[model samples]
Each structure stands twice: as structure tokens, then as C-alpha cells.
Target chain A: MEVFIYGLARGSTLALMAVGFSFAYGVSRLPNFAHGAFYILAGFATWVFAQSLGLNYVLSIAISLVLLAAIGAAMYRFILIRVRGMEVSEIIASYALGVAILEALRCKFVGTGFSTPVFIEGTIKVAGVPIDLQRVVIIAGGVVVIGLIWAFTHYTRLGLSLRGIAQDERAALMLGIDSDRAATIALAIGSALAALAAVIILPVGSITVNEGYDVLISALAVCIIGGLGSWTGTILAAFILGFAGTLTATYIGTMWESVVVVAAIILVLLLKPSGLFGRQKEFEERV
Target chain B: MDILEVKDLMVFYENAIAINNVSIKCETGKVTGIFGSNSAGKSTLMYAISGIMMDMKRKEEMKGGERITVVGEMRLNGEDIMDIKPNDRARKGVVLCPERRRIFPESSVLENLKIGGYLASRSQAQETLKYVFTLFPALKDMKGKEGGFLSGGEQQMLAIGRALMAQPKLLLLDEPLLGLSPAMETRLAQAIKKINEQIGITILVAEQYARPILPVIDYGYVLENGGKVLEGTAQELIDNPDVKEAYFGV
Candidate 1:
């Protein structure tokens, strides 16, 4: 029961972390490897606002999300825009930028500790297993994000336009949905989502540069196992990885968590190269 | 009056010319046909008029790949629009029903139509959606079905219906009959005529097989190897020996 409860929390965290990355890739086809940077940066920014500047925590979160979104949009517009079609350059460029931001943050806060206050602070026993309210919040937050995204893509024009551009760029262009504009919106929204996840999860532990890299790894794993463009696949992959990690840690050893994640990625790759729901371009009907 | 006029348009990928000094015009409220065999620059010409070549050129440059050069004047309603972005041109009422029916495979038929109506106002989209359904009832029947699951004939009809949802003044259709049965081909050809006659939307259709299309076109141009080979009324093209033998396969 404890593993089950915690596994849900862990799975939701993974989903929140990767949803933005998956979404941006789906719409813009640009892999924002800087997703980790956005997450860590937002954490620090919120810390500074709420702790250092002594502002309202909620306001700090809102402001930090906006700033992160702007930064993300600028990154895509200036850097990723130049390498739109070259997949390797996009990966390298975004990853390098991510490393640069993280390293720069480390330089500033090396001697100091950064952490955000959780929205709620308490513990509750569920199924006789004590779970923190923060974990419940994380689970709830993840569900809300997923639901909002589903509604956004289904009911909103901008969301539909983004989905349209993602599906077929030429077809969307024919309908006056500009790919550049859509990509910019996607990057902004992607960054905001990453920040939202950061604010929710950073409360559980200290904000560390090490965790930024780990976040990136988790997101990549989720996206890869889910298939890059499949949202439902991302959620399912997150749960599978989360449960597997929790199970392995409980049964085998805590140290085997990372190993298990990597092994699962390799196994999935070997078994289903295009992912569970990913479109295998070579096999899909062209028309 | 001419709704679209391309004068001495030249397109090149690196050094290889895709469109070689081609000039064509589509009269307002009339169906103009551009016919050619495979590799005859028919698709290139369609892309050029719809302003998608600009996007292609931009993508190529961004990738540091082949240099795509498009030169010459293109006017939509007597205003020069040669260098505009594809989406902006679409906003200005030029839409392309791309070859091979590039409908959104993941989206349902209704969603596909809604995406096509991206530029229209809410009421306009609703009205056009109704019009589209009436024109292609199969699309209405498959409103809940994903586009990928549709048959080839149904896909082509959806493609045309999708284009109509865009509220276009000049519709550019590239190979609307590339892969379809004779019955479907004839039906789409008739639908194209109905769209022009009823809605009075100007159309420029490019196809390799000109048999069904030729019957509905007002004026036609024959393109061979990226250059214009012949230009005349539909009857005149039918009367021309080379066009009849090459396009009609008769």
C-alpha cells in the first residue's frame, strides 16, 4: 500500500516533468533539451522571489513561470530557430544551453541552499501508510495539468492550431496557422509547464543542480518510452517507470533505481523502437 | 479579372531549376488547370502560387541544406505577394489542398475540418463546415473517425472539403486525383466544378492525369520539363495532339 501510494506520486512527478517536453516536441518538432534548465531556473527564481525578495510565494511562482516562459521563447526564437530541420544540431544546441544555465546557477548558489515552501504542510495516513500532503498535492497537480492540457487541445483554437501544425506543417500553413508563431507559443507553454512542475516538486527536496540533470534524464526516459510525440504514452511510460522504480527499490535495493530506469529504456528501445504509440514513419501510410 | 498571376516565375533548388521561367494566371471565379506528367514541375508551380515555396526556401536555409531560390512576380488580386509567408498568403485567401491528401491522421474528420477553418470567424467556420458536409456527406458520416482510417476516395473528398473550410478565394489543388479509382476521380472532378460554379471560388488544379480535370477546366496550361508547352482553352487542349496523347493516355 505504501509503495502503491508513493508510486502514484512518483509517476505523477514524472508526468509533470515530461509533459512540457513532449508537448513542445509534438507542436514545434523542436527538442528543447533546455527543459531541465527551465525547471531548475524556475526553482531558483521562485526561491529568490519568495525567500530573498520576501514577496508572496504565489506571486513569486506566477512571476517566475512568466519569466521562464519568456526565456524559453527567446531560446527557441534565437537559437533553435536556426537549426529547425537539423535534429542533431537542435539536440546539441539545446543540451549545451541547458548545461550552461545549470552551471551558471551552480556558480551563484554554490555556498547557499535553495528551497521552496510547499503550498500545504502536513501528513496523512492512507491505507495505513503515512503520505505527506505535498505528495497528494503533486498527484493532484499532475492530474489537473493533464486534464487542462487535454481540454486545451480539444476545445481551444490556439491549442487546435498547435496540434494542427504538429500533425502537418504544410496543411496547417494552408489554413493560415503559422508554424513559427505556433512554435513560439509551444516553447512558451512548454517552459511554463516545466516551471509549474519545478515549483510543485522542488518543495519536497532542496533545489540542486544535480537534480536538474536527473530531471532531464527522467523526462527523456518518459518521452522516449512513451514515444516523443505521444502524450498518453508519456503518462503510461511514467507510471510504468515509477512503479518499476519503486518496486525495484523496495525489493532489490534503493541504489538500483537509476539502473532500472536505464535498463527499461534500453529494453523498450530494443523491443519497440518507435515507442508504444509512436508513429513508425517507415510503416505508416503516407497518404 | 485574374485572381492570381505569376509572371516569369523561376524556382531553383541549389542549381537545379524546378520551375523554369513559367508564367500562368487563373481567372476569378473560374477553374484553371495546369497539367503535366511526373517531374514536370506541376507541384512546384502549385507550391509557388500558394506561397509554400517561401516556407520551403526558409526551411532549407535554416537547415544549411540546399539553397532554394524563387524569383519573379506573383500577384493575388493585382497585389504583389511573391515574397509573403505561406500562412500570411493563406490569410489573404490562398489555400492549398496538398497532393496525396495530407489530412491530419491523428485528428478526427470534424477536427480536421475545424483546423482547415483556422482563418475563418466562428460563424463562418460553422457555415462552411455545414457546406463542406453537404458537399461530401461521407465526411459528415465519418465526423468521429480519425482521418487515417478513411479510404483513399474518402480521403480525397475530405481533402477537398478541408480546403473549402479554409474560406479561400483562390484554391490551389495539387494532384487531387493522384491515386484514386475512376469513379472517385470523376466524382471529385464534378465536385471541383460544383465548388467553382456554386460557391464561385477561383481554383487552380494541377494534375498529371488530366482526363477528368480537363472536362471541367476553363483554361489550361501544359507543363513539360518545368516549362510551359501549351496554353489554350480546355477544348483547344483536347484538340492538341500531344496533350491528348500524353495526358489522356488515349
Candidate 2:
């Protein structure tokens, strides 16, 4: 039961991470492979502001989110916008961003040692299992975040416009959805979610630039397993991967489990190229 | 007073000119038909007026000149609409249903209609949804179905219905009757007449199939090779032997 509780806690953080990837891809139609770099940067930024400076933990997180969102918006205007016209160019630019972010993070604080502050501290029991209070907080926070996003997309005009653009960009623009504004908003929201995930996960483990690739690969696998454009699919896929990974780790060595997990994802994609929940582009509109 | 006026509007694809110095006007409460052969810049003109062309310019390193403008010299009593944004243009009574029956493929039929009324309040949008459902009652049953699953005729209905949700003074429809059966065409034409006469909205329709549109259009412009070759009343153009040879080919 404790093992199950641990799996659920880890799944909550994975859900948060996958949600950002799915949300950004839905609205922007860009893979944003550099998203893991944003995850790493969020930890580094929060560490510098919140831990190093000893500022209020919440205030540092707020600063980290705003800073990362600005980075995302700037990248959109400068790099993404330039390459958006060419598919190959956009992918190449995204990888370039990833490399640059890794180098910048390495230069700043690898030696100084950066760590994110614990947002929720203590212990609690759930279903007769003793779980860290932070785990319960993570689960509750993930639910609230997901609920808020669903509400925002359904209830607000801007959110509706964003969803409209995701479905049909040109039509949305013709309807006056402001494709540029919608893209910016999606990027900002996606970046903030990534940051939140980093904060929640940090209490469980230390974060580092070298681990960036692991996060990227795991989040990407979750994205593909669930489907690239479906938010619900991403969260569900993350949970599936999390539980599956935990079960495999318990039975087998952790080293061999990653390979088995990836092979399973590959098998699923071979059967369904659009992922578990993604719709095939049959009759989809093209501009 | 003209609801929309385009003067010397030119659009180009890279180095090639798609539309050159094209100008036309639609007076209040009239259906103005733009008829053209394939590649005659009919759709290009529509894009320029509707602001779709403005977005294309950014990608091609092109810029819109000061010469081309939209919603000009029109008034509901005395307010100029040219100053309004494309979406706000709908609120101020100018709307475009668009060509190729651009329905939201993944959304429900009801959700598809709601897109047309993107600027309306929740209650207002819902009310407009009811009005549109009444016109195309086939949509009432399919509110939960994905738009892509609809038949071509039904998709066209949803498109027209979506545009009506905006409740505009001037509704611009591009190729509304394209890719449909003869029976469907007649039914759609009847639906359009009901919209104009009953709902009291002015319409401007562009078509390659001139026969179906000719019966309903008041004034017509015949375009050949991106230029206005002729302009006259529907009957006057029908009577002209030149129009018969070039357009009607009768």
C-alpha cells in the first residue's frame, strides 16, 4: 500500500510535467523540446532566489515563474517565430535552445550547488499508508492546477480563444482570437506549470543540469504515450508510466527498467502512431 | 452607403501579384456577387477584405501598403467601421462566414455554431445558437457530435449557422454553394434568402458557380484575370451576350 502511495505521489509530479508539454504543443504546434531546460532552469532560478537569498519561499517561486515566462515569450518572438515557417528549422532551433540552456546552467551554479526549497513539509497517512505530507500537498496541488486549467479554458473568453486557435489557427485569427496573444498566454501558462512541477519534485530528490535530459525524455515519453495534443491523455499517460516504472523498479533493477518502459512505449506507438488518445488527422482542416 | 469598400487593393505571392488594383463596393442591404474563373483572384480579394491576407504578408516578408483598407465609409447612423479590428467588426455588424465551409472539425455541431458568435456573451451566444439551430434543425441533433463527421451539406449549414451567431449587419460568404449537390444548393440558397429577408442581414457572396447565385444577387461584378471585366444588374448581365460567353457560357 505504501508502494502504491509512493507511485501516486510520483505520478502527480509527472502529471504536472506532462501537462506543460501537452498544453504548449496544443496551442503552439511546436514540440518545444527545450521544455526540460525550462524545468532545470526553474529549479536553478528558484534556488538562487528562494534558497540562496533566503527570501520568502512563495515570493521566489513567483519571481521564478515570471522570469521563465518572460524567457518563453522572448524565445517565441525571436527564435520560434523565425523558424515557425519551416518545420526542420523549428526543430533545429529548439535543440539549439536546449544546448544553450544546459551550458548557461552549468556555468552559473554546478559548483555552488543549487536546490529548490520544500514548499510542503511534514507527513500524513492516506488509505492506511504513511505518506509524506508533501506528497499529499503535491496530489492536491496537481488536482487544483488541472481543475483551474479546465475552468480557464472553458469559462474565459481568452481561454476559449486559445482553444479555438489550437483547433484552427487561421479560423481563430479570422474570428479575432489574436493568435500571437494566445500563443504567448499558452507559453506563459505552460512554463509556470513546468516550474511548479520542478518545485514539487525537488522535495523528493535533488535537481541538476545533468538530469535535464532524463526529465525531457520522461516527459516526452509521457506526451507520446498519452497523445501529443490531449491534456487528459498526457496526465493519464504520466500516471500509467509512473506506476509501471515503480512496479518494474520494485521487481527488477532500476537500470534495466528504463529500457523496458521505453520498449513498452515503442510497442504502443507502433500500434497507434497518433498515441493513445490523439485523433488521426482524417478530415482535419489545413490552411 | 457602402458597407465595405476596397480601393486599389493589391496582394502578391512572393514576386507574383495575385490581386492588382482591385476595387469593389457593397451598398447597404444588397447582395453583391463576385464571379470569377479559376485563379482570377476572387478568393484573394475576399482575403484582403477579411484580414486573412494581412497575416500571410508577415511570412512572405511582404507588407500591406496604405492604399488597401477595409470597412471604410460605412455607418450605422454615423460611425466609421474601418477603425475596428476584424473580431470587433463582427460586434459592430460586419462578419465573414468564410469559404470552403470552414467548420471546426473536432467540436460538436453546437460548439461549431458558438465559434461564429465568439464575441457574444455566454447567454447571448446560447440564444444565437438556438436561432441558428432553428434554421438548420439538422444541427440540433448533432450538438454532441464532432463537426468532421457531418455531411458536406450539413457542414455548410453549420458554417452559415456559425456566422449568423455573430449577428452582423454585413455577412460575407465565400463560395457558400461550392461542393454540394443541386438539391443541397437550392436548399442552401433558400436558407440564405431566409437569413437576409427574415433576419434582415446584408450579404455579399462570391462564387465560381454563377447560376445558383445569379437568381439571388442584385448587383454583380464579373472578374477575369484579376480585373473587373463587367458590372451590371443580374438581369442586365444575363442579357449581355459577352457575359453569356465569358461567365454563363450558355
Candidate 3:
């Protein structure tokens, strides 16, 4: 029961970290390598706003989210736009930006000493397992976010345009959807999502600059195992990895948790290069 | 008056000419056809007029792939649109039901229509949705099916219906009859005529096969090797021996 509850919470956290990455790739075909850096940046920004600048917690989170969204848009407008179609260049450019941001933060005052306060302080027992109220929030938040994303894509105009572009860019263009504008919106939304995940998850533990790389790795592993750009796949892969990590920590050792996640990714890639539900390249161009 | 006019248009990929000084006029509420064989620049002309060529050129340039040059004067409703973006062109009521029916394969038939109607007001979208269902009742049945799963003829119908949802003043159909049976071709040709007549939407259709399309077009241009070789009304084209031999297979 404990493993189940903890796995569920862990899976939700993984989903929160990876969904933005999958969404950005799905809409723009650009893998946002800086997703981890954005996550860490949001955590630090929120901390700076709330703790250092003496702003309200809710206001700090709101301001940091908006600022992260702008940074994401600028990242695309200035850097990613020039190298849009080249896959290698996109990966390189985004990864470079991510590394730069993370290393710069490390150079600054961000260290083991900084941590964000949790929204609520309480513990609840579900089936005799003591769980933090925030853990419950994480699981519920994940479902709500996924549901909202599904509804947005189905019912909203901008979301429909994003789906249209994702399927066939030129076709969307013929229909009057601007490709660059859609990509920019996608990047901004993706960054904001990263920030939201940070704000929610960072309160559980102290803010560490190295967690940026760990978050990126976790997100990449989940996305790769799930199938890049497949939201359902991301969720499924997250749960699989989440449970695997939890089970390994429970049985073998906590040191083997990261190993289990990485091993699953490698296994998935070796067995099915396109991941579980990834749209194959050959099928993409069918009329 | 012409709703769309292309005068002295030329397109080049690197140094090779794709469209050589081709000019065509589309009169309001009329069906204008351009017929050509493979590599005859029919698709290029359609792309140029719809402003997709500019996108292609930019993409190619960004990739350092090819040098594409387009020299043309495109006037839509007496307004010069040579420098406008493709989406802006679409907003100006010029929508392309692209070649090969590039409907969003992952999207359901209903969702595909909604995406096409991105530029329409709510009431306009609703009204057009009803009109599309009436025009192509087959699509009404498969409203929830993915576009990629539809049959060729059904996909063609969906493509046209989706374009109508855009509230286009001018609709460009690029090879709407490709890969369809003779019966399906004839049926689509009739539907094309109905759209032009019922909606009074000006159409510029480009096709390699002229037999089914030529009969329905009010005026047609025959393109050979990127240049306009012949042009006339349906009756005049049918009467010309060279046109008959080349296009009509008579």
C-alpha cells in the first residue's frame, strides 16, 4: 500500500516534469533541452521573490511563472528560430542554453541552503500509509493538468491550431495558422508548465542546482520510454518508471533508483526505437 | 472583374525554371482550371498564388538547401498580395485545399473541419459546418473518424468540405482527383461545380488529368513545360486539334 501510494505520487511528479517537454516537441518538433534549467530557474525565482524580496508566496509564484514564460518565448524568438528545422542544431542550442543557465545559477548564491516553503503543512494517512498533503496535491494536480490539456487541445482554437501544426505544418499553413507564432506560444506554455512543476515539487525538498540536471534526465527518460510527444505515453511511462524506482528503492537499495529509470529507458529504446506509442517517421508523411 | 490575377509570374529553383512567365486570371464565382502533365508547374503555380511558395523558399534558404526565386504580381480582389505571408493570405479568404489532401491525419473529421474554420466567426463556422455536411453527406457519417483512415474519395470530400469551413472567397483545389477511380473523379468534378455554383466561391483547380475536370471548368489554361501553351473555353478547347490530341487523348 505504501509503495502504491508513493509510486503514484512519484509518477505524478515525473509526469509534471515531462509533459511540458513532450508538448513542446509534439507541437513544434523541437525538443526543449533547457526544460530542466527552466524548472530550476523557476524554483529559484520563486524563492527570490518570496523570501528575498518579501513578496507573498502566491504572488511570487505568479510573477515567476510569467517571467519564465517570457524567457521561454525569447529563447525561441532569438535562438531556436534561426535553427528551427535542423534537429541537431535545435538540440545543441537548447542544451547549451540549459547548461549555461544551470552553471550560472551554480556560480551565484543558489546552493544547498535555499529551499521553498510548502503550501500546506500536514500529513494524511491513506490505508495506514502516512502521506504528505502535498503528495496528494501532486497526484490530483497531475490529473487536472492532463485533463485540462486534453480539453484545451480538443475545444480551444489555439489548441486546435497546435494539433494541426503538429500533424502537418504545411497543411496548417494552408489553413491560415502561422507556424512560428504557434511554436512561440508552445514554448511559452511549456516553460510556464515547467515553472508550475517546480513551484509545486520544490517545496518537498531543498532547492539544489544539481537537481536541474537530475530533473532533465528524469524528464528525458520518461519521454523516451513513453514515446516522444505522446501525452498518454508520457503518463504510462512515468507510472512505469515511478513504480520501478519505488520498488527498487524498497527492495534493493535507494542507490539503485536512478539506475532502474535509466535501465528502463535503454531497454525501451533497444526494443522499440520509436518508443511505445511514438508516431513512426515513415507513417508521418502518408497522404 | 477578376477575383485573382497572376501576371508574368516566374519561379526558379536555383537556376532551373519551374514556372516561366505564366499568367492566369480567375473571375469571381467562376471555375478556372489549369491542366498540365507531371512537372508542368501546375503545383508550383498553385503554391505561388496561395503564398506557400514564399514559405517553401524561406525554409529552403534557412536550411541552406536551394535557392528559390519567385517573380510575380498577384492581385487578390485588386489588392497586391505578392509580399503577404501565407496565413495572412488565407485570412484574406484565399484557402488552398492542398495537393494530396493534406488533412491532419491524427485529427478526427470533425476536428479537421474545426481547424480549417480557425479564421471563421462562431456563427459562420456553425453555418458552414451544416452546409459542408449537406454538400458531402458521406462526411457526416464519419465525423469522428481520423482523416488518415478515410478512403481516397472520402478524404477528397473532407478536404473540400474543410476548405469551405474557412469561409474562403477563392478556393484553390490542387489535384482533388488524384488517385481516385473514374466514377469518383466524375462525382468530385460535379461536386466542385456545385460548390462554385451554390456557394458562389471562385475556384482555381489544377489537375494533370483534364478529361473529368475540363468539362466542368468555365475557362481553362493548358500548361506545358512551365509555360501556358493553350487556353480557351471548354468548347473551344475540345474543338482544337492539338488540345484534343494532347489533353483529351482523342
Fnat across every predicted model, in order: 0.75, 0.31, 0.74
Ranking by lDDT: 3, 1, 2
Location of the lowest summed lDDT over 10 successive residues in candidate 3 chain B: B241-250
Worst 10 residues of 1 chain A by lDDT: A278-287
Model 2 chain B weakest 10-residue run by lDDT? B62-71
Error of 3 at A151 (Å): 0.9
TM-score of each: 0.97, 0.87, 0.98
Better of 2 and 3 by DockQ: 3
Count of residue pairs whose backbone atoms collide, per candidate: 0, 1, 0
* DockQ value for model 1: 0.71
Tens-digit lDDT track for model 3 on B52-96? Answer: 999999989888999999997999999999999999999999999
Instruction: Give the per-residue lDDT of model 2 (tens digit) for B1-250.
Output: 7777766666666556667667778877878899988888888777666666656555444223323323223343246543455555556666777887777777777666666667777797877788888888888988888888888888889888877876677888888888899998998888887887777778888888788778888898988777778888999989999888777767
lDDT of 1: 0.91
Off by over 4 Å in 2: A1-4, A111-114, A117-119, A125-129, A284-287, B14-17, B60-94, B121-127, B167-169, B198-200, B242-250
| lDDT for position B226 in model 3 | 97
Where does model 1 sit among the CAPRI classes?
medium
* DockQ metric for all predictions: 0.71, 0.35, 0.70
